[model samples]
Target: MPDSLAAALTGLAFGLSLIVAIGAQNAFVLRTGLRRTHVLPVVAVCALSDAVLILAGVGGLGTLVDRHPAVLTVARVAGAAFLLGYAVVAARRALRPGAVLTAEDGDAAPARVWPVVATCLALTWLNPHVYLDTVVLLGSVAGTHGDARWWFGGGAVLGSLIWFTGLGYGARLLRPLFARPGAWRVLDAAIALVMVAIAASLLLGL
Candidate 1:
């Protein structure tokens, strides 16, 4: 492969390796996608935010972030709180026997756009893990590509776009399984646990 192609492939693989994990952000995206609610905006925010972060990392902002530990410290506190709160909500939903996960529940309420977008932003921005992966780790890796760092960043950005798009849209395939209320309850319960675990990890500075 050519240098540029090699760099891009390296970036893509690296990016996917980091992002293809079960985390709060992925949980939110999966849930929202299952619900078919504001998938476009949610995916857009995630992909674009990632692109910005990756670029910032490659641009040497990672060094600046490292120099200022306080920024990440603040993010850690707030992100933990946010995750904890979200977990409580998810737990409540799971506990509610009447709460159906299917989008067609007669009592199912339509979600507004902005609130979902706000949550998406919070999930994307507030988490220090994201910064660590995209800015610090990816940035450091990109530096190794030398002049091809930008291409590497570009590939990472593309990876993010493809992942988010597929995840958000591909959720529809699970619609049949999620058609049952029990499936939704289980998913909510899992999400709640994941959120709590990540939040605790953040608080403990893990």
Candidate 2:
């Protein structure tokens, strides 16, 4: 295979590996997807945000980030606080235990667009793990591709788009399972746990 093709494949695999794990952003995306509220905008925000970060990484912003440890530190603090707050909200929803979904009628009125978009942006951008994965690690790896670094970045961006689109759209298939209030409660509880665990890891630097 050509160097470009090889680089692109490597980037795609590496990107998937980094993003496939359950994390704050994934959890938010999953919840939003299940609700079927503003799914397009949310998925777009996530994919586009990843594209920007991946491009920045390939463009050498990773070097600047490496030089400034304080940037990650600040992001870590803010991200942890945000995750904790979100966890509380998820916990509250879990406790309420009345939200249920249907094909014709959603759990409730769909949320306004901008707020959901904003939340998606924050969930994608505020997490320091995103930076570590897209900026530092991906960027560093792309650099090894030399002239093919942009191709590598493009592959990574493609992977992100594919993942988010599939996740957001495919979640509807689970609507039957989520039709029950108990299922929603269980989901919210799990989301709360994920958020709390991620926040704790960020705060404790584990």
Candidate 3:
């Protein structure tokens, strides 16, 4: 393979490895996609945000972010708070029957667009893990590619786009399972646990 192609594949693989894990962002995307609510905007926001961060990382902003410990500290605190709050909401949803995640919720009024957009933005931007993954780790990795770093970053960007799009659009396949209100409760419970665990890790600096 050509050097450019090789770099691209490496970047793509690395990016997917970083993002394919189960996390708060993925959980939210999965939930929203299942509900078929604002899927396009949510996926777009996630993809675009990752693309920008990956570019910034390749452009050497990763080094700047590293140099400023204070920034990371603040982000860590804020991210923890947000995750904890989201955890509480998810827990409540899990406990309440026919509350939000009811399988028969199709007849329910659609959520306001602004709130969904806001949540998507907050989930994408407020998490310090995003910065660490996209800006610092990926950036440092791309720097090793020398002249091919930008090509590598481009591939990473593509990976983010593909993943988010597939996740948001492909979630329909699971619609049947989520058709049961119990499944939504289980899912929400899982999300709540994941969020709380992550938040605790962040708070304890683990």
Candidate 4:
């Protein structure tokens, strides 16, 4: 049990170490949470997608992904482009002082939950870095311990569930801060800047 606990703790550290970094998914989640729209579905999509990838990582599929350098490179560049596009939109939103940031404000028109869920899933699943983070990197690190691997896997998935949910839900607490139009601009601009910065880092190979 002590060994299990240690593995779990190590997994948690591994998961957090990889995911805690700034990226498109976190930025999108934060932006959506701040907008007070489709928060639950978004969070579910992110968490569930992580679960699948983590499972793949634990089952040794991550190593396969790691070997395919070409595929991973394509994904990284594509993902970075998507993130940069999002950064542009976020910046535009920041400039528009009266944007409501609701379902109505989006191009979907009908504003279905499925699209939000789909978007989050794609963002989480299609990105190559997630595999590197959870499957290859964390899996390689955790596989050193034979029986403790499960503990590590479980810990990593739980960390993801906890984080995406907290980040999605926790942003709600900032409602009052965003209520003030000035604060809203600040928050949106900050989100935009972070997104662009991450995108740049990815493109620049940093």
Candidate 5:
């Protein structure tokens, strides 16, 4: 295989390794997808955001981030606060007995598009871990590719697109299970726990 192909493959593998984990962003995307609410926009936001970060990293933004510790510190604090707030919302939903998944033509209304978009943006942008993973780690890795770093970044970008698109669109398969109100409660409860745990970790600098 050509060196470019090798670099691209390495980037793809590394990106997947970094992204394919349980986290606040994935939890939100999964919930949104399960609800069948503005899936396209959410997936687009995630993929596009990752693409920008990866490209920026490949362009040497990682060094700047490293030089400025305060940037990540601010992001960490803000992200923790946001995650905690979201956890409260999730906990409330879980406690509400009426929190059921509405049918396609049910009386319940879907969430407003912009709010969901805003939440997606916050989840994507506020998390310091995203920068660490995409910008710092991936950028540092790409640097090893020398002239092929852009190709590596492209591969990482492609991996992100594939993952988010698949995750957002594929969550509907679980719709059958989430059809039950109890299932929704269980999911929301789990989301709440995950969010709180992540927030605690962030706040404690863990």
Candidate 6:
């Protein structure tokens, strides 16, 4: 394959590889999207985080993460714990009866943007798996390229933008369905189940 073609194809694959996995961050994005909540702030934080991590991965930080098995292990355990707590919260919300809905409450126009952005940043950064997957593993893989390092990182960032934007804003089309209180409960319960399953899998390595 030609160099440019090779770079783009490699980038596409790299981006897809880093995504397509279940995680709390993604679930939150989808939830917010369905609820027609804050969109730009959520998408921006997710995209920016992806760019930062991709850059770190391409710039040789992967070596440091690779050498620090203890760090990854600690992060994995901590992430699992966090997920467990979040899962319980989601389950509770799902099972609870919702308050009476009104036009004002369902408007979704009141969604705060900055706080949501901040929350996303914390969630993306705090998870240790982010480092392992984006900075370490993807970085190490990108390092194999002789002259396509930027291509690799760019591809990864593209993946992030696509996924995050899709999750955070794409669900707007389903707003009519998700606007219902019962829909929220159903979504929350589904999120909880997925989170619990992922947390257990991470803890058990199965």
**After superposition on all CA atoms, what RMSD does each candidate show versus the true structure?**
1.4, 1.5, 1.2, 3.0, 1.5, 2.7
Tell me, by lDDT, which candidate is best. Answer: 1
Q: Any idea how many clashes model 4 has?
A: 0
The residue-by-residue lDDT of candidate 3 on 1-206, one tens digit each, is 88899999999999999999898899999988888888999999999999999999999999999999788888889989999999999999899976755544843766888898899889888888888889999999999999999999999999999999999989888899988888988999999999999898888973
Candidate 2: Cα lDDT at 133 = 80
lDDT of 2 by residue, 104-204 (tens): 35646887999888878888888998888899999999999999999899899999999999998898899888777788888889989999998899989
Clashing pairs in 6: none
Better of 1 and 5 by lDDT: 1
- Candidate 5 is scored at a TM of 0.96
Off by over 4 Å in 3: none
**Candidate 4 off by > 4 Å:** 100-111
Candidate 4 local distance difference test against the native:
0.77
- Candidate 4 C-alpha lDDT tens digits along 88-158: 77777789976634432432343577877776876786676787777788778778868888888999999
Model 1 CA deviation exceeding 4 Å by range: 106-108
Superposition error at 200 for model 3 (Å): 0.5
Instruction: State each model's CA lDDT, in order.
Output: 0.93, 0.87, 0.90, 0.77, 0.90, 0.76
Worst 10 residues of 6 by lDDT: 99-108
Q: What TM-score, to 2 decimals, does candidate 3 have?
A: 0.96
TM-score of candidate 2 versus the correct structure, residues matched by position: 0.95
TM-score of each: 0.97, 0.95, 0.96, 0.87, 0.96, 0.85
Error of 1 at 178 (Å): 0.5
Q: Which residue window of length 10 is worst by lDDT in model 2?
A: 98-107
Q: Stretches of candidate 2 above 4 Å error?
A: 99-108
